[model samples]
Target: MSVTRRSLLAAGAVAFSGALGPLFASGRARASAHGYGPLLPDPGGLLDLPAGFSYRVLSRAGDPLRSGEGTVPSHCDGMAAFGAGGGRVRLVRNHENRADAALRVPAVDGLTYDPGALGGCTVLELDPGGGLAAERVGLAGTAVNCAGGRTPWNTWLSCEETEDRAGASGYARDHGYVFEVDPADPHRLGAVPLTAMGRFAHEAVAVDPYRGVVYETEDAFVRPFGLFYRFLPARPLGGPGSLRAGGVLEALRVPGVPDLSVVDRPGAEFPVEWVRVPDPSAAGTPIRFQDFGPGGITHAQKLEGCYWGGTGVYFVSSYARGSEGAAADHHGQVWSYDPRRGRLRLEVRFGPAADVRLPGDSPDNICLAPDGGLMVCEDGGGEQYVFGVTPAGEVYPVARNAQDIGGPGAPAWGEFAGVTFSPDARTMYVNAYTPGTTFAVTGPWR
Candidate 1:
């Protein structure tokens, strides 16, 4: 039942290739020329791109910094780039750690968190040529920063993806929430968590400007499925500093499908919508029980990477199957939600079962290339790798951690997580968590 890019395109043509199909429906489109073959080995131990591609390591974990900050933490997760004054690039990166272990905050003046485990968030200024200009800690004392989206006003929303209410230690209030950090500010902003965004295991956030809606995904890997949530800002264009004010939170529920079980073979045309769910922690709530599966399902999956491109919001589900039951339908799905058309459709699927055999389910963040293709971070095995897929649905490896610096097992940090392009779309920057490093790469494609 695995679907390949070629097969998916064929299916789309037969099912809805009219005016509704993707813009790249016809193979004659310019997207066809952007095709990239599989990865080839390079003698320099760097990513081997097509004839015109080249890469350079910009920043590495434990590397000395002019900011006087100590060593960068391992587990680098989500990140966002901004245009700094004087045509420099500012990047805000998140360190996903629960604070339960040793805290590795750099020695920056205003950077360290209280519990020490407030994972690291650093704002580094880079030159247009991909050189580090300046660096500072954006926020500190946050826990398990999984993934977050960038604000149109030039800020990064770093999310703490944890809900450890009761454990060996006591409960930490407001631990699982989203924090807004200003890359330009050397000191931490307000350190305020947007409670209105709902308290859950958040994986990533995607903002829709046209609808003024913020789409978010949960990463509950334990019991219930993760849930897809949408936050409606009380005011349109809540501006840059209005996230903590208030908003409405709603979950996703497929109507007409009673049993609501995960669909293993969800058709490309499966319909979905944002459904309101009662807050589990509501005061007057009397009964509480464990509810898994699709119907009466309280959550969705560990949705990792998300991006707004090609006239829609593209999101990925890191975990396709849970111990509760068989995977709903497919493993690692790329879904496109067109706000204008008010519809959601499956664009591609990845995993061992899919036609294209990817490394594993450890898909982290994603970015659309200037050539109109998709770049993915493979976070599964310790042998982390980055993948690039063409519009024609060709998947190939772009980079791998063969240098042995990432260590044995592919720990969360230091693994390749976030991928973004320069403002001119001529350069690509990739970051890893464990060893904490950022690589600047340029190729013929640019």
Candidate 2:
């Protein structure tokens, strides 16, 4: 059943009517209705899927492309697809290298940045049959092209997930902002870094069309924990391409945790609320939602991947370390935020036993399957694999990196980072970051 905003508001009101402090205790009733265990495999790698489904490499990093560009760079991260002129598909992919080494590219048309550091974006046009026909640099000269999302207006928002401004001389021009790119006309659009979105380590973005809101996640790993942010457009129902126009940025805050005496689990659901971050430009703003999980007084884990799926927004915590006195459960977690239901709920938690365990604790990008399932890319482990979870909570391996898992020239099958399905849902495209390669897989899902 599709839930409406009004129904969610009513549910929220009932949850908060008695006492906001125990709202989650009452929310348990709702969780029971949607609970499911993670489908990842165990540590020894015994997890396997049905025989029919398989994957193949479409393109890879360092692979000599038809474009004059010498070779694709390492660290292929976020990506998005758009329909092209001749029934083909255009893919805008990011290279997350922040080191002071020049990225080798045959041509520099869509490239940006200085010569020393190797980081930027690339656009590849794939023919209807899933063959790479043309390629070019999309946005060059950026640092750490982490993970970003697709815009509703047929564009890709590539986010730089770093806060380093060493080369900026004082103010960073584009260190930690989302860049808008047109995959169709890669050279025509000058890279416009959206600074008003806030200067933090952004992991991924999920736009809410109904509310005209862009939900973003911060991958802050320093002193303060990361924050879950929402960018409310000044106007109602604005186009996704206009995200750079500016909006209100707010942080998530769990009520009442000042004395350091309160005990709560980080995974425990709470009556969380959105608190405005008076000035996104101000780096001194206090974090609103801090320390509320299993590890008593824990902070928000590094939120990496997110997608809009089945009546809610699904998010993932790459890993959550235990706090002061709690047991450390480095396993990643997936949460659901039902805007229409006005409630944020925990859906699945993956530990060491799942089919695609996060042995290295780096869960990066995720995409929803057409059949109400999820496809996840593992960023940390030595053996990178694309894992899928069925709606029934069954986990299976869809693809594995055939090359090295990390660093340049890594195995393509070991480091799958981004996964997306074609509009028809008949084909799936997966990309590996370091040894940049995008592959198209088509088969019947048994």
Candidate 3:
């Protein structure tokens, strides 16, 4: 979503994706341009923001969740913000709980679709200054509810990150699918799954509002890798953005460019085409590989987050390597797809290290900033930080989590995720995955 700001200062930051090569702009040069200024250490030792910037934990795991039986769950992932009018806003967030998490998702009778599923969603309201107004469970009894998109219809689409078979792992029903939630109603959250969106290892989704189409990303991490998919709504003219209404699913192809892996460098261009998929629903074998085998349809590895912007749709391929069945190796890559031009362009390329890994530097969730830049959350090792990549291609640290709760683990850090900004751009909301926290950041946001 394009962040609308109260002042121009809130308009100056953003971030990227893709394979590795000559960056679109020198990372060093972008550094010189300045961000919120170096993040001063957070005296609280939890989060460190720029000098004038500050943050507050809006919610935390184990804390009581409104309208629910117990406390909030951890692994907070994707999120979105909606204006509540009168200097208020609501945040719909995803809890990426797997089928086997010890923490339970409260089941609200008929509102629950699957009793065995542990992943779900939550909602919190923020005041003008970013203080918590209210909080509660938004969706329940689902599994691997990862990253999803915000719909113009004022709804949140929470995607399940698995194509798990039914009756498996104590599940009475199949677990891979998407569920829609309304930010305003905590009492009547729909427990239904949007099956027509196609089932696979879903990462994130972005909606093309004008066309009523939803673009999806897959991070299967298997031999077949994952395919970038688009869903065409069955009732486009009706303007109903429900995946439950059903639709046709398609995979992207580079046409005559059979090899398909051109995402490794900045400015790499390719002719993009959409191939129709016969079935929109499948588990282990996604339609991409089933209908068009290995070389038949073009695809990439670890295709993760996606965001629909005014210019084009931005997407990312977290990291890739032959080990993960990738055609090439790189830390990550960012690409923009313009349906109008039927073209795909590589925007940012991180690295081509022999090993495609972002030990402590991978960009996961993303949001468009008011300045027309990108806000990125790193899901890698060590102390994780949220980065702001300016429209001019400069990247800088925006916020940091110094929570000692995670304590010396291999990654030694909590993954910063679920990044999104208030519609007014006056507040920035993000999540820390481990000791789950929802932080609302405010200050001179330029």
Candidate 4:
């Protein structure tokens, strides 16, 4: 749901002294804020949270699945939570693995799309108290499952972040497509790829429930960068299986603005239009390299997480550095696209900082909080954290990954991903990219 300005201001009003403590008191996120207080040290050496908060390790990599077929997969990425009746919650999580992953998502009979591919999604049933009841594979046979968004019809969209084609990688077919996973029935939808949605390096997707339109982000880090896309389906609001019928895939184009990273200031607005992609499949050439006339498609570096808010769709460009072949430099940016007005506005932008481990850098996998704020996962260097950004743009740390499984001298801290909240807003779910672990944190939410 899109958060209202009034609600965000109200959430920002409740501030506590020393919001981020000494660690984050020197950055753009140093503004007065309200978090669950400074995170206390974790005794178990897994996760660090505020005094009154605690986390439970819901799933771990290399653990045995309840199905008894194979162990849990590594590199857990995107995920979504669904109501599973009787107050039970079901989680559909992505395993961003290739054939070389140590533990892969076991390919089940009906759910396997390609026996050679090793990336897919797993379903976790959590009881009301946040205990794992069952775990099983939901979708298999895809590669590099990254991040995806939930649909209005209560299903999860799993995206593959690779462009590996058939025979090139193994003995399978072309990858890099979006697959819908129904948490209620793991095998109902099967492993069919929504090809009309386009085949590129997809990072994530968000559905505009009102218009039934889907917004997509491409994470192509090469010179051509990546483009923001929208898929308009033939059957709007038809729920599951509606996207299979196919639709037009278009990329956002801003007149006179070829690269989005050029606009460094927040509140910068640009009138935008959608250009139809000549080839959704990009059989030979990639979509970003396709022709679009003198008025070309707009692109950005590291285009990542996105969600449909109350009025527009909020998306993130994790960062754009000049040294990295980008148009400009910035630590991070959050943009809002007003679909009705056909305009895009920069909501938040972080200034250049020498510290790479700050809470605001490389923000990924974002989701709207119940308190009218944003919970963003950090994909930066060193220690990783889940940062909370109030409507007023005050940033604070929510959770930290203290996965010290590699001994004291060798801490194994992985980037945070898949930051999401439960339906009741009482529990927050986050994933550690490496040493793949899912955490369910519950506490006094502000």
Candidate 5:
């Protein structure tokens, strides 16, 4: 059974009772826990938070960057936070623009990897109150640099979300790879692309720090539905920037299921397998993993954001109605991949349209909250919102991005990008995509 905004009415019942832990309750979720309660319209016409919560816009597109000749790059997407000591926080953000979004940031004299590719990463240091301290370009000359993950060692793993190869897409070098950046490094600014990570349309990633295992999601924005992957480092990552040391990449598989779209209903589970990807880089040179199809790899539609939580790796599957040849009909889905159990469970899912109105459709990036809930940033057609879903399937509104920055009648559609929190858990930070802006939110947490 799918759900919609009206379904939120049913959610109020579950939320008020605070009875959310049973996985079976997920299908019944309709309403939300809107953090602090229902959203109060934003008088400023930017973003709306619960009654006791408020936000402060810290950065935006075209603002003169702390360094460089031009304004900060736009299309601000995936981001992570690092403690910069003295109560300051550091953010590493991705500019998902492609080769055409050029000349935005001046490339360093001798540090960039591919001048033909425009996507890169920006590092921002914020004061204790979330005020911008300093900003600089951390990595440059990549393509479609989208959402990435944070390493346990305090470095950011920025991923390239494009399969545009050099010469073909006007790229000087092949694109689509992961790069590591140390936000706190004061001396130089050079990025090393971790070639071992597969070269598909990379989206965001999550690392199992305890095992040095890296899990990735593919954004299938192009041809061929995307597949979920994992990279087993040759050697357990020793510290920051160690991904370049090399590793083996593998895609997920079901022993005999034959298809990856099995994650249909809420709480649906499947046994998992990892098939080796000989040529993770997909580089033409000495090609090894030529037959990616021979492995009978299972496929899913638009595997998006992922986060390593206490129970497993929680990931999102953006809306799918079996369109683009997907095998099922799911508006949105959430799965938890448990390595110990060798299984992936469909923790939650939205409606199939024509039936349910679909509350919080097309969910993308996700992050864990202090209360053990998930803060989901929606990238759909309706009013953009950051929704909250508890372990027991009780959903709530965390924030409503009411900013109509896209001009008149733009469909009220906006992609809420980054959704992360400060190390102290006292402050929350998120980004509104395009005409990009970063915001810090604060309030009581219980």
Candidate 6:
């Protein structure tokens, strides 16, 4: 079964897959000139990009979808791009809205899962020239639809970032599960949560195509922080609905490294192991709180964007501050895990310096660029930007969020999300978190 956006809403479920892409531009002179060079301000005052590049606002919140059933939702978060054949493309987007939000995803009949919840996903089909062709809601009525991963079989794993349970805060069913959205078929009705994937403050997931294992990250920030997880599904490469069959959820343990925040140096390597989570459902308590022997499972703060690349999975730790009760402080960190060798390596660390302009701190959604580098989205305070990081750890700004949503004196900087490239690597698609807007960027991509 394939899962493309249009196919999912019109039929039932369909599947499609494509590689994900860049991130924070560093303040270094050399890094600044590496990618497309300095960002040329956008006269429209929305997104600022380099000289040869241009962007178009494909869709915005409140705009009527092509289906005419409802309008585009707010707080667009994680997204993936898939080829729609005939040189066209389709995008599966997530809306991270809460139940109380003024603008919520419309609960279309049969397509919605929860009547009281207000988060889900929207699908946009772009023409070969990067023009909007069609738009519709692919999934609906899920809470806090946050970052998720793209399956090798071409389906999107839309994750609920909240752990709100049934009978709590107007919720009718338990949240915090991964729901698969097929962009290839549009006929499926009702959303089914993948319970075997575990229930926590889910952030993002990365699928190991070879082993058919799904790795997940938790973004919970409390006394226990969050734990990295891996779901060993019952059926490997079984396509859509396979994950629902069941799986064993386990947490990563970096031996003696109880807290990931303490690791400041890049290139740090540690042998790792996975401990089975006693309760993947988190029926009574969260998976992170459960006992994992004396050694315990390793934890990190703000565990966010995850993607599969190279020999393993690459995940991000947005930022850590000692004042916030973390072990050590750092602007940001990117770690890569090589499952083949059972080893974890920290590839990038923002700094010992407090400068946000240096490496663009608090990096959020990330992807491996077509140019063999990494592209990252910044979610920190002040001006937000999408940056690119070369294999050498050098950074350059790919795009900047120049949207003046606050009017006059108050300039609002909305963080960029859902950074992914087309299958042909000719166009880039991204989202602005607030005053939701999806941009289709085309330029001289090197």
Query: What C-alpha lDDT do the candidate models reach, one value each?
Result: 0.62, 0.60, 0.73, 0.82, 0.74, 0.81
- Can you write out model 2's per-residue Cα lDDT over 189-256, one digit (the tens) per residue? 56666766777788888877567677788775443556777778775355545766787886655565
Q: Which ten residues in a row have the lowest lDDT in candidate 2?
A: 12-21
Q: Which residue pairs come into collision in candidate 4?
A: 2-309, 2-310
Candidate 2 to truth, TM: 0.76
User: Which segments of candidate 1 are over 4 A away from where they belong?
Assistant: 1-51, 100-103, 107-113, 166-173, 186-188, 256-261, 264-267, 280-298, 322-324, 327-329, 356-360, 405-414
- The sequence of per-residue lDDT tens digits that candidate 1 reaches over residues 1-446 is 22343233222111111111362343333334224444455677645455457777776666665577665665667877777767688888787766553445453445443444547587778986678887666777667887898876667788877754433233344366787888887453646667777666677888876666888877765445566667887864676667766777776655654322253343355566665546633223211122323555334456778777756787777655545543463446666677776666666655445434333445779887665667788776445667666565655556665455543674232367878877767777788665566777787552
RMSD of candidates 1 onward, in order: 5.6, 10.0, 6.2, 6.5, 4.2, 9.0
lDDT of 6 by residue, 1-446 (tens): 11232122122111111112222223223222356767777889889887899998999998898988788999999999998899889999999998777678878777788989989998899887788999988888899998998999888999999888998769899999999998766446358889989999999999999999899999976758899999999997789778888978999999989899998766678999999998888988988899899888899999999999866898988888787888988777888888988989887777544233355358899986767677788897767778776545556677888886676886668889999999998888899998799998888886
lDDT of 2 at 1: 8
* Model 3, runs deviating above 4 Å: 1-32, 186-189, 237-241, 256-262, 293-295, 353-360, 405-411
Q: What are the runs in model 6 whose C-alpha is more than 4 Å off?
A: 1-33, 354-357
Candidate 2: what lDDT? 0.60
Off by over 4 Å in 4: 1-32, 353-358, 405-412
Best by the lDDT measure: 4
Q: What TM-score fits each model?
A: 0.82, 0.76, 0.88, 0.91, 0.89, 0.91
Model 1 residue 286 lDDT score? 10
Q: Per model, how many backbone clashes are there?
A: 33, 38, 11, 2, 13, 36
Q: Give the TM-score of candidate 5.
A: 0.89
Q: In what order do the candidates fall by lDDT, top score first? A: 4, 6, 5, 3, 1, 2
Off by over 4 Å in 2: 1-50, 101-117, 166-174, 235-237, 256-269, 282-298, 323-328, 352-361, 405-414
- Cα RMSD of predicted structure 1: 5.6
TM-score of 4: 0.91
